[model samples]
Target: MNRTIAIGDIHGGLKALIQLLKRIDLSPNDKLIFLGDYVDGWSDSANTITYLIELAKQNTCVFIRGNHDDLTEAWLRTGDLNEQWLQHGGQSSIDAYRNFTSEEIKEHLAFFKQMVNYYVDKENRLFVHAGFTNIRGVENEYHDTAFYWDRTLWEMALSLDDKIPTDHKFYPKRLLLFREIFIGHTPVTRIGEDKPVNMANVWNTDTGAAFKGKISAIEIKTKEIWQSDPVHELYPDEDGRN
Candidate 1:
């Protein structure tokens, strides 16, 4: 049978990314959904995109745009970036891209530009880089910000006690539109854990792969998880999103 795998933020951890794919043992028919933030930490931000471009040739891949990716794309277009962008490992991305040719830069920029904000599979499994403000859909609702930046949705879930009153549902009705929701912007590691944290009906897969934690990937149907070694271990010389 085919598996629908949702991956967490990469943050330019190419070693982790490669190890993750190996661990998944992707099948020909399986689909890989990347939760984004593929650049701006560790190293190989440029090479990581190049690898994904090649991988897409043999397997179905869904790339969602994350805030970091948006910043990178903006930098590529204007040839300038602000401190906010550069501070959060964005300088690494600039360094990575600096070695590319004009055509390579355009190709990578186009790749980032074409990334979708959110994706709803046939099973109604919503895959997004970050949380959404409202559940109506991301096409127009918070089109520019919510899809790749909102955290309140996940915050609401985390705020509630796991065991609610017998008659009360764990979450609001708005988030129930999808059978399941997967996101990657919020690192579970920062929440006092280094693994994917599931709350209510949403799963936060970002295990801080760009920082000291590992990159994570989960098979949506079975919830089977696979992880790469700690990113810091892979690139000891670099300062990851720390």
Candidate 2:
């Protein structure tokens, strides 16, 4: 059977990504939906983007734009550094691209431009780098930034009572928009989970690979998970985003 897998934030941990993919034993028939933040954090940011671009050529892949991706694209296009972004993880990305040719930068910029803000499958599962604020649905979102920056949706899900019926008037209108929502952006490690966390109908896949955590992926239908060794272990010489 063809499987659909949702991957967590990578944050330029290409080694971890490679290991995770190997463990998954990828099939061309399977679909890989990446939750983004493809660049930043680790030392191989530029290399990670190159790897992903090539990976897409051999497999079914959906790339969602993450906040870091947006920031990196902006800097690559304008050469204007975002101080906050650099402090968080952007510096690594910039350094990684220092020796790249203008043509290569343009190619990578084009890839970033092609990323979608969010994707919904036939199964009514929502895949987004972060969360959408629209209570109505992603189509109705007024601010595009919310697609890659919003945390309220996940917060609401975490705050909910699992016993609350979907039909309950107090149940969030947003959660009703899809059968299930898979998100990245906010690391599950913040909640002490080194794996995906499901609350209400939202599943957070970010396992904090940017910091001292492993990269993760989940087969949506089977809920089977795969993870890499801790990203810190993969690149022990450097402090990731910590």
Candidate 3:
């Protein structure tokens, strides 16, 4: 089978991303799918985005929009925004783009907007920035807020016994799609430890690269996992202060 590598939240760890790619030994036939959160957190969001854009130009790179990316796009457009972004590692992104001119910012925004909400294959595997909610008849509604920022869904999915509740009056069915959903939000302390209650689905990544945790990537078909050591630390004083 063709190799498909799914990388978790990068959070501006450009060096780690590059290192992880080198460790993986990617081939021309392999595909790399980034699980979003490309910017923010670490000190190299701008460089990270530039590298990803260049990589996409050369390889079969699939980008998914994360909550941070959404806020960055919003900040780029309005220049007026809330503090949540800064608190959650958006400062690095701000710092990264500080040197860029207006034209460069516009170009970056164009690339960011081009990211897809999710990447699905013919097999039972699905890659999304965040877990999806079974809203109404839709399997994954792909709500921008939920897709990028929501943790409640992650908690609910993690806590469920066997079936995901669709009691929002939006979804009548108790269970959504039967395929396994691979997500990146709600960072786990250990990789591959969290397992879905109902099915073979798994939230096998997001080891918290922004909070002094490892960065993870996994092979879709082989279930091979790789991680990088924590590169930076987040102080408690930095919390909620941006």
Candidate 4:
């Protein structure tokens, strides 16, 4: 049977990404769902994008767009860098592309343009870079930023009781609308761990691989997980997210 895997924000941790895939023993038959932020934070963003571009040729890959990805795409297309993008690890990705030609930049921009904001599989599993406010109408959300920047949904999930609230339930239980929701923009490292964290029916796969943690991937059906070494160890000389 083909494996269904969901990976978290890569943040240019190519080494961590390689190790995570190796740990999971990912194959061509695997349905690879990559939560975004593929570039930014660490060095080697170009290599990371190149590797994923190649990996897509060999596997069933779904790429979701994260906020960082949007910024990078915008800059590549128009050479416009906003203060926010530059402050939040955008320089790292820019430096990573110091050797690229105009054609290569355009190619990379095209790849980013192809990325979707959110993807729902046949099983009703929602895979997104960040949070979505309306589960039912996720595709037509008014605010695109919510897909790559929202954290309220996770906060809701985290604040709720583990068991289905039989008494007074939260006004809007977003997790109840799907089989499961998988997200990546918010790093689990903030909660004091460098691994995937499950809260209610939502799974946070980002482990801060761009900073002090590692990259992660989880099998959707089996709940099996794979992680890389600390991202710092992978790029000791570089100050990630600096």
Task: Name the candidate that leads on lDDT.
Answer: 2
Rank all candidate structures by their TM-score, best first, as comma-separated numbers.
2, 4, 1, 3
Q: In candidate 2, what are the lDDT values of residues 1-242, reduced to their tens digit?
A: 89899999999999999999999999989899999899899999999999999999989999999999999999999999899998999999989999999999999999999999999999999999889987889999999999999999999999898899999888899999999999999998999999999998899999999999989999999999999999999898999899
Candidate 1 local distance difference test against the native:
0.88
Candidate 2 has its poorest 10 consecutive residues by lDDT at 128-137
For candidate 4, write residues 1-242 as lDDT tens digits: 89999999889999889988889987888999999999998888988888988899999999999999999888887888789888888999899999998888777877898999999999999998989887566866779999999998888877876665633455454677777899998888787978899987789998987788888899999999888998889898998984
Give the alpha-carbon lDDT of every model. Answer: 0.88, 0.94, 0.71, 0.87
Quote the RMSD, in angstroms, for model 3: 4.7
TM-score of each: 0.95, 0.99, 0.82, 0.95
Candidate 3 segments whose C-alpha is farther than 4 A from its true place = 135-142, 162-176, 190-200, 233-242
Per-candidate RMSD vs. true structure? 1.8, 0.7, 4.7, 1.5
Q: Model 3: how far is 126 from its true place, Å?
A: 2.1
Task: Say which prediction, candidate 1 or candidate 3, comes out ahead on TM-score.
Answer: 1
lDDT of 3 by residue, 131-240 (tens): 56655412447555666666655565665555434454443232355356677866775334432122225564787777666678888767788777564643233321
Query: Judged by lDDT relative to the true structure, which candidate is superior, 1 or 2?
Result: 2
Off by over 4 Å in 4: 163-171
